[model samples]
Target: MSATEEAMNRRIVLARRPEGEPGVEDFRLEAGPVPEPGPGEMLCRTLYLSVDPYMRGRMNAGPSYAPSVGLGDVMVGGSVSRVLASRLEGYVPGDLVAGFNGWQDYALSDGTRIRRVDPELAPPPAFLGALGMTGLTAYVGLFDIADPQPGETVAVAAAAGAVGSMVVQLATLRGCRVVAIAGSPAKCGYLREVLGADVALDYHDPNFPETLEAACPQGIDVYFENVGGAVFEAVLPLLNIGARVPVCGQIAHYNDSGNPLPGPDSLPRLMMWVLGRRLRMQGFIVGDHLDRLPDFVREMGGWLREGRIRHYEDIVDGLENAPAAFIDMLRGGNLGKRLIRVVPEDAAGA
Candidate 1:
């Protein structure tokens, strides 16, 4: 289709800056003409759009690792899409690729920042989950940063979610004993039964900290932190000397406005522990470790192919449901990697 003919595309835009927690009114759905691919560009139809906790930081008005979405602009996101038309030499129609396509039915890209996918090796949605950023986050954080050794105890919060789930499986594959902390009993069961965690505890329990302490009697050697706030507070005392902490996300504090939680500032105590114990605590964005992506893809893909690493996806249908799905994800409603099926590319036969 010609660029002018494709101008009737639909998209979700940022309606307003969210305060505390985001509501449905914060997004505006609009219909516009399909944008034509310019010279050296390609037209893409989104198949799967990712909904992640990190996007919460982009909705607020502040300086972040990435730019915040401006009012009336299409909300930014990563998506797996099929190239509808290509002006770029390396790309062609029917090629599935992953890129920053935002939240929409279709997007135009200049062939930069897009990676082609091999569907025969894995399904398309795997490009958004296991073989994509989520897998990279877990692999890089655990192997490169945390560096858990064989027979060591590793603890992960939000252990049944995307990054956390991958960490549990990978750590287990590495011969490390894994203890997982999930939000509910069901999620904990998935961690133990499906992902092979050595032990799983529900964070909702009144004595969750005590349970976690009991689970890690040797102290946590590697802590893959996905949920911060209370979980971090609970894990602080349980960290062994020379332990490694890979700070990935802080979903627990994502919806908090500016109000501090009821507690004394624990920075001093944390610093003391860091100094006294010679612990390594580091925060990282997955993009910073892009050089390791090739290694991660090769290893993770092999594991998945061998039935060693299993992944789950909680997919919602349509572009319009993105906002609600995102809100629900922040509330721990999603069991695994939360995604929205923007188009039924994978359901071609159905």
Candidate 2:
């Protein structure tokens, strides 16, 4: 972290807007002088970088809930970092924190939107996963939006993923029968054997629709939607009256080329079912619910301590590999929360 030890900063910047699915060519890695912390700012060396599904939306050039990453700018993301120098109050050199550091080896923060990470609560990398925004996203989406009742059958798409995994566990803890859906048998096994889901279904099965229907004989009372193409098509008809759906992400459609949907138009039928079922569907961005972070941290922290909640991370090493790892993650290649390890946990000044 010393200026004598490191002279340049390495970062990945958006090279171009992706046409459909992003490629490594869309990003460019560059080196520049490491930034200095000015008044009230802290110099942080990146430890871990989170790669998430929502980032796909940010790579586009269209309207979205958040601002798109402009060409030539650092790709937007959250990171776990170690403060190397501090002019900011309450923080000092060698303090680990979680904040927005983008895809870089180092960054400067004015202490805005940064939180102290207690290594005693969990590992530093965990701040980018279970005990961080990923966990908070699941907490807000399930307890605040979906609000599954005891005994209600809750169907979760991508149930083995970072957010979906959290949803499955939280819903199960709420006393709901969880029908966890994943693309692979191994993931489904994790959902069933490890996460305690009532039922687990693999979406790749040819009879997936029928299997899903059979899994929820009473009909799905709550659907935590993460993947939205055929998965939504199958879940729509099975939704019971007054069902609640918290739309978290549509990873299935994130790579669409803006072409028309391949199957027969189902909009009319979807609308009819929506009216007849009185279903409530809400799409939420977790950043808007930051007020709930303290409650989430406290409750989820207890669950982690009691072994009631488990978190898994698929970590890729090096800042240079972030682009490739991100591309692969979009293709359902990651099992849990995917992260890029920028620095070793036991490194000097860490």
Candidate 3:
């Protein structure tokens, strides 16, 4: 009936709005009795929880594409969970699912749009990543927005992270010369050696702009803007005429108070490039492309089965560690899809 009428639940709630960079203290661990499910509803036990850069934006008390995480509310996230109890017709106990279960140990759902997780196809984390929103975002941002052509050069910032890694794989398979940009040399190596990027460069290099120039001698045809800021400045000059830019994320500016980044060039310079190069740069929310979910699942599923698409996860154990994992991921401390294993694999009692 009410929140206090159900079983005990443990969760991470938003403690405070971050001023600049979000600190670990911004989240608070809370315990309360779980809300009971009514008719046409179900209770889900969280298995794997996602920690993303976008969550940092939600911690602020301001208007965004989505509503902000209210102070004392559960920190928002996507999770792979199992149905612990159900009053709905289709859902039953032990049915694995993927939904917006947040950082809590359990969730109460009215059985609206949540999808079942098929472990036979892929692992649970893959749904939170590659075969899920992360992969779809990469698909839309690269193929739909960027529209990269074969034999052309396509560059990606944050190239070793979840969406960025997928971008490199898709663009590379599409016959584009993929150049990966990342924060460290190890990530650069992973991009080049493992993901098959044609060229991988470290953005932390003092002469990064020059290095990017040398890598893309023929000029970049499509630029997947993930870590905007200094990366944006480096990409602007190397764009070819009629180049496409998918403004997916700006992780470099996520911690900024008001100003996203204080790079050498101004906004006026960016506008000039857009006008002069006939460039088309647009922002997107993957949720906007939900109509294509079936298509994504089929194709991405095939790719996964055939080993055409490979995914990675930087997994941390325990639900209590979720906040720290999220904080670390924001700082590029993780190498892949950062996730918290809220429950064990045998949590369903095998």
Q: Which number leads on TM-score?
A: 2
Encode model 3's per-residue lDDT on 187-297: one tens digit a residue: 999998889999999999999999999999999999998788788888899999999999878888888887454455676777888899999989999989988889889
Q: Which clashing pairs does model 1 show?
A: 6-34, 7-33, 7-34, 8-33, 8-34
Ordered from best to worst lDDT, the candidate numbers read 2, 1, 3
lDDT of 2 by residue, 209-310 (tens): 999999899999999998999999999999999999998899998888775354456777787888999999998989999999999999988998899998
Candidate 3 TM-score over all chains jointly = 0.95
Alpha-carbon lDDT, every model: 0.88, 0.90, 0.88
Query: Clash number for every model?
Result: 5, 0, 0
RMSD of each: 2.2, 1.8, 2.5
Candidate with top lDDT is 2
Better of 2 and 3 by lDDT: 2
Candidate 1 local lDDT, 1-350, one digit each (tens): 45437356789999998889999999999998887788899888888999999988889887778899898999888899988888888888888899989999888998777888888768888888899899999999999998889999999989988888999999999999999999998999899988899999998899989998988889999999888878888998898999999998889888888743444666677789999888999999999998998888889889989999998989999899999999999999998799999869954211
- By lDDT, is 1 or 2 better? 2
Per-residue lDDT value at 258 in model 2: 74
Clashing pairs in 2: none
